[model samples]
Target: MSLRTQLTEILPPLLPSNPSEAIKGTELIRLARLQLNGAYSDASLRYHFSIMSCDPASPIAKVEKGQGYYRRSAPVPALTGAQELLSLSQGRLDDLSSDHEAVDSALERLRKFRAVVTRYYEVNGRFPYVFRQAFAQGASLGNLWKFPEVVLVDWETGDAPDEVFALDPTMLSLKQRLGLPPFRLHAARLRIHPSLASFREDFFQALSASMWAQGGELIYAAPVEDEALADGLRRLNAIFGVGVISFGLTAQALDDLPRAANILNAHPRETEALMDRLQINRIAAPHTRQHIDWQSLDGLRRESEEVQHLIGWLNDCVGKGRAEAFRDEA
Candidate 1:
């Protein structure tokens, strides 16, 4: 059967006598045409019919313009809102000879798009508004069009979760494939100062003790310089096939510790509290040290409470063996 005839069989009937209904019916047909041909330049039966009978100022004209916008806004050459719609039509195209291959190709294209989007998120800590909006609209249409499988797969892979930790080989591979930076690189990006190295080592010792109390084994516990620690973590990550959590004591240490997956600051409780207050007040990190009111008892109390809360949260993350405990509440 012709693609148009097949589409008409499944789509709801629209009365030819009613202009509005006809416009809607023709749009559905146009979408099908775009899907099959990969472009809208070719004239189809519906296109010719519209040219002959459809009103010049009909709503269909607006939809046609919108479709053009959708195509032009594609992030990658192979993906656009129209192509996404095509991918969602996989199950409905079962009768088409090339359905399986077409669906697989569409899926692979979507995956590549996903990889780019994931990388953007990792670098910026948020999705670009245009792309996010496109994905949101696509997801809504996928459901409205009864393509549940498309929605399901996209949700499982495209959505980013909070506080991902690297602990195992599988997780490491998944993170790398998704464009997430390793712990060491992520920490280095934070650009924390070197004055806090002693604090980091102390924090690690405390954390190690807490884990040991909970029956978690500590394979390495020596106090090494920041570079040595980073090297150790890299070795452990490669040889032991696990994520390495290491500390850098100086600004230069971060450069040296390329293999560490997680780098934490080792500030005193009071210092941490002050930093928390600055962060809560939207103060820039560079200005935090100068802005803090050290002698304000009320401010001190508030900062202390914030520090305690952070420590408690970290404790929970350690207990759960998942970094998601650190995600800010929405």
Candidate 2:
């Protein structure tokens, strides 16, 4: 059978309408290579398929262009073009079977992860502890004093704690007795100066540059909402030419803050007096502490574990499936 006839049979389901001329032109180049003892020149191939460069409708064209966007860290365009290619081939390009529900589930999980990361960044002004801890130590000067530590809870893992308590890292073994979830103990040391003078400026600049290059916005977490704070943020946004989204503490944060405060306050007499003055209920003794909802925190931990599992499964499937498909084709 002619190469063209064989390609015609194999190509249609994969490239039914090559509006960008990528499939047709590539097939023509392959045919030329076959006819010329597989010795076609680069110039010939380029000349034959050059038109595909200008046509964005082809899956191959999208993939090629999407690679450039990805290299430039332009995720919006890169993913858009990638999705286009995936749609055109019905995901067969990835060797994904039509019945691959796992693939769909993994993709959905990935989307959820992206959303969680984005929301966390908006609220916390940084990535989660998992993403930042590896570089946190190396990115700052350890000789100058300990960096300010920020506790980041996985957004999927429930609400972020309102206040961070100082704990001896070595004493983390007491987490179960303290009623703290394992994930809540993770912390990332921030590289901000203690004076808090240039921290905002430097952070905003870095965040703005990153978002501009990668297609995201810099968000600031506002600990509290007030007219004065809102106006100041607006002015800063105007001056920097970037939007600063303000987020307040989560319900969980509000509820947990008082409890954390109660634990950290060494002077129980003063705390009791302040609570009485403020008409706030005082926490009971440690042994008689109110029953907390451990289920919510447990659920968060489960989600984190599931996300990691899905990520590994997806990576393994894509790598092995693509390799096998390539070997079969060859």
Candidate 3:
């Protein structure tokens, strides 16, 4: 058999699926020889490994920022333009498979992660509003460009635990007079995985989704352990100003958590326990602009009822002189 063919056949079982646990090229070569049909030299085998790793169809994949190889998992359903996850859409879910249970589980994980992120930010003093209608089943795919999964609101003065935070009236008035927004708004895109292949889309989507806001964030549920993936995110952040963060929750970790509703309503002690589980990593800090794009925001208000609600909530807070958590009336 050809060396490439031999490696492809023998490598699946030998390679680790997790990028962090990838086997070094030397170790892989040694293991491959046991099942390799012919007596190939180490250098020739290494060359084949390098060449085959670059091919997506090949069984082997070289780690981007390190010396090792791993097994690439199956691709998720996504849009071709930005590779946005379409798993929430009914049409795309049908394309996933006949196994409905697996689909339900994947979606459960996504919701749980979103709940976790919302609560995490809430505890940290940032109010988060979710755009549920945008990603609901049967929702339009183009919503990815127009709306972020979550919008984080940073008040000029506020505290957690209090149902309502008292805004500093003088500061708010001063900021309004100075032509500066009294609060900061950041749009965030959340995902379960951090992959070298899909991160560019993730970053850009966060950037595009936040064009109307003061800043943007790309948050991942899983730990970004791969050095190269982290480096790529940093480089993109440096150029584009969108922040990147990882919550350090693996798929299994998310699965172990309580239901999304339970997570969102966790009490102080319970919330603290949940926070202890996170190994949060801020890959990059987002650049905050002093002014929001009012025109772009107005366009969104016309297209999205959620955006209208958000603006209404903000206006109510400003008028009442208290920054409070958003309560959905619908």
Candidate 4:
């Protein structure tokens, strides 16, 4: 089958075959397209093309454009093992990828697709590419990639509870791939579940705009911090009135930005986790300004996209009722 046909077949019936044409050459949405594919990229990978090891120097997969889109080059070859894993998640998709080989193919595609459009609404102000095929096993899942404040626990105070949660690696990779602006997590407190860490990104992103635009004393009506968050979270908990909000999100993907504050307020699990990140234990690192890794700001600037992706996933709970098709990828 044709690449376009394959993309149309496997994708959630909504994506366009000629995304460039449909998006009118926008770079922002180009990232979205990449993520849509990554949404399918998971550790429980379905086929050989879904792996990331194929691209040795860099990661590149066959991106099919319209017919005759390639002037001289041919489509990418069918890969086996890592290459195949890097190619596609589904058999049909792999069959449809490029047969051509190029050193800087992925980089070239990034440049070529610069005209792609992007979305303006801050889906948590964070980028949307952090989740990808190999992300979960990588380095930054849960406490591993937490904010400095998160890692600092008081040896004297007793170790905090270790939190564990599941997420789609490929979807996470998508967040890292497309770096969006940074956002914050406003909540009651922290806990072990990875959801709280994610809350920080989404909560902050929504507030950044509202606070920046409205100039607020902040609504304690919602949970901006962990301790006082519950009163705020219940609003969203009752929304659909079903499923475990802690399992994922109270905020949904297409959820209205205005509603997020309330939805976040409704989901206290994530907020409490944020509070946990902020806790000052007797650990030598200390919460005092002295131990803080202010220098990380530079790195964080570079990683803001990952942060955004985190927020997007966190927010997807209430608005969209889940992360961006991540479980399949993770």
Lowest lDDT block of 10, candidate 3:
82-91
Candidate 3 per-residue lDDT, tens place, 1-330, comes to 787877878999999998789999889989989987878999999998877765546777777556798886544454222122362221222254566677668778888998999999898888999888777656677777778999999987744446348887788999989988788999998888876567777788789999999999999898876555677789999999999998989989999999999999999999999999998988899998878999999998998899999999999988998888999988
For model 3, what is the alpha-carbon lDDT of residue 55?
57
Residue-level error in angstroms, candidate 3, position 305: 1.3
Per-residue accuracy of model 1 over 9-127 as CA lDDT, tens digit each = 33323223222223443465555564453343445645633432223222222122112110111011223333343332222222323466655544443333333222323333321
- Best prediction by lDDT: 3
Cα TM-score of candidate 2: 0.22
User: What TM-score against the true fold does each predicted structure earn?
Assistant: 0.19, 0.22, 0.82, 0.16
Pick out the ten consecutive residues of candidate 4 with the lowest summed lDDT.
113-122
Candidate that would win on TM-score: 3
**What is candidate 4's lDDT per residue for 154-258, written digit by digit as tens?**
111112233112233444445446642112222111111211213333233222212211111111111122211222233322331111112111112112122
- The predicted structure with the larger lDDT, 3 or 4, is 3
Local lDDT at 103 for model 3: 65
- Indicate the residue-level lDDT of 205 in model 1: 28
The models' CA-based lDDT, in order, is: 0.28, 0.30, 0.81, 0.25
RMSD of each: 25.8, 25.9, 4.2, 23.5
